[model samples]
Target: MANSFSGADMSLRTDKAVQRGPALQFTVDDQLVDAFSGESVAAALFAVGRRELRQSPRDSAPRGMFCMMGSCQECLVWVGQRQVPACQVPVAAGLAVQTLSFRRQHLD
Candidate 1:
């Protein structure tokens, strides 16, 4: 069952006016996929079967979407900044995404 937010259940996003028309199309890690224009960067990633978009160098733990509301650090990333939540970010055309593995973060 979907998690309930507030007293009411989490209704489908289709009711939102922003959900009109087809969602913006794009590729994540070179894989073509579709995501709602209202969806954040992380949502687009998950739709493409990418659960671990990055890893912590210290512990090397897999990191991706944790708090769908951008509360946890698990979904943290760098879009030019450290620890940016993927779920809270919106998908945009020409978004150049680079995976930051433990090795990649420290190499540079």
Candidate 2:
């Protein structure tokens, strides 16, 4: 599949051409979504309009990408019970991602 960028180009793009690779399939919140190769989990989620990646451990407040460099823990998620920061995880085909909020909701 040919890769295409949607919307205006950013000025900071490198001189090296961006390569669009095949779309990868991953499951988020039990729904299948397509993400491009080399894309981060956070990017995949946001592309699909999934702003709430997890909830606060204290009071269940929704959380998402912030300080995407991994300094902030807002984008926490589970990949087969292993907690990971979404912004730091690369998209993989057939990956099963469960937001902390979903786990709490169904486990109770």
Give the per-residue lDDT of model 1 (tens digit) for 1-108.
221121122133335555343456554444444555666777666654567877776887777777799788677655544546666667675553445653265546
Cα-based TM-score, every candidate: 0.60, 0.76
Clashes of 1: 5
Question: Clashes in model 1: which pairs?
Answer: 40-89, 40-90, 41-89, 42-86, 77-84
TM-score of 1: 0.60
lDDT comparing candidate 2 with the true structure: 0.74
How would you encode candidate 2's per-residue C-alpha lDDT over 1-108 as one tens digit per residue? 322322222222233876856777777767776677888888877766667887676897888998877879889888887889999988898898888878778753
Candidate lDDT (C-alpha), each: 0.57, 0.74
| Clash pairs detected, candidate 2 | none
Report the error of model 1 at residue 99, Å. Answer: 2.8
Consecutive 10-residue window with the lowest summed lDDT within model 2:
3-12
